[model samples]
Target: MNTSLPPVEAAPTGPDAPPPGAAPTAPAKVPMAELFITFLIIGATSFGGGVVAYLRNALVLQKGWLDEERFLSALEISQALPGLNATNMAIIVGDRLRGVVGSVVAFLGITLPGATLVMVLGVLYASNAKNPYVNAALIGVGAAAVGMLTAVTFQIGRKQFGKWIDVAIILVTVTLINYLHVSLIWVLLTVGPVAVFIYRPSQLEPPSVPPKQETVP
Candidate 1:
């Protein structure tokens, strides 16, 4: 009878290790000018309910300024803050990247352009209450905003599904939030403990001590 060789175990890899001279990965650094420009553009384009969705796209998907987890955390924090969600998010994200100066720059980037645009629109609406062009433009922009929001949703869903448990949580949270209109606190209260119970990683035990040498030794 012939004996087959046992399967070999793979070697552990170090962070600096790469396969066959592959290109090295670079560390991420914040680009302040780009950050300001991005938020400014998002502010100008984001109308009505499009702020959150556009911010997600501009910051995470398009610019890669923040990863998914960081983006989600910023969103949560912004929501808890007083003021508009987009503006609050700008401050948080800016501060995260460039400290206080970054926060101020980000705020001005989002607010100044938006303020000017809104004021102009307000004047126009007041002067020309029944203008067809205004109505048409608003309707078209609103539809585009919906498309952007949908894109943001899809992006977030993709990130969440990177983990199987995340997918389950997402599905459940979406169901509760959409159908039941429950607050996030309630959702967290229901799912947080259960998730902890189910997915908690096992703590490693200390190596066992051998029995004390016998007195006969």
Candidate 2:
């Protein structure tokens, strides 16, 4: 007589399944406390106007929280809107990782140190405004800030500057704003459309060729 036990079925797997004998993967949720602490450290330690660079180092290089492309995308969105890029980035990234509470914590963490320092510095500057040393130091700082800004601008725009079309746009925008004294709203309304038209899909497509004429019978 046949007395063999029935065979058991193995578990099924899909794209997200781990390889056999591999450890199970965990979800990508970041702890709220860790998020706040990380941003707080970035805010406290970042010097000059290089908070963005510091943020990249911490989030991308050190923590592996955001990759380069995601960071730049976040930065573009932040700059396109009307707020500080660093704080905007904090809010965006935080919200992405953990929603509303994350946004609040990240914003507070990144801004609190700077805000507190600014208040202290403002009080000190008010009392010392009359001192010649303070005046000279402030002037030096302003000049250095201008130089740093120029350098950073060129560095960030180096790839775009390599293209003649981009350079032309830059020159035209500068001339319109600086020399022509055109309102930014008008300049954007005028130049924006023209730029879009210049690079439109139809403009880039080659002229279609007609089929050759039929041969004589």
Relative to the true structure, how large is the alpha-carbon lDDT of every model? Answer: 0.77, 0.83
Report the error of model 2 at residue 176, Å.
Answer: 2.4
lDDT of 1 by residue, 1-217 (tens): 4444222212234334444324323324355676678888887888765688898888877766677788999999877555788889999999988789889878988998879978998998889878899889888989998888888777756876687877888889889999989998888889778776775566334558896777974
lDDT of 2 by residue, 3-75 (tens): 5422211113334544433422332455677788899999899876688898899887776677788889998
| Top of the candidates by TM-score | 2
TM-score, one value per model: 0.47, 0.72
Which residues of candidate 2, in runs, are more than 4 Å off?
Answer: 1-28, 67-69, 201-217
- In candidate 1, which residue ranges exceed 4 Å CA deviation? 1-27, 123-217
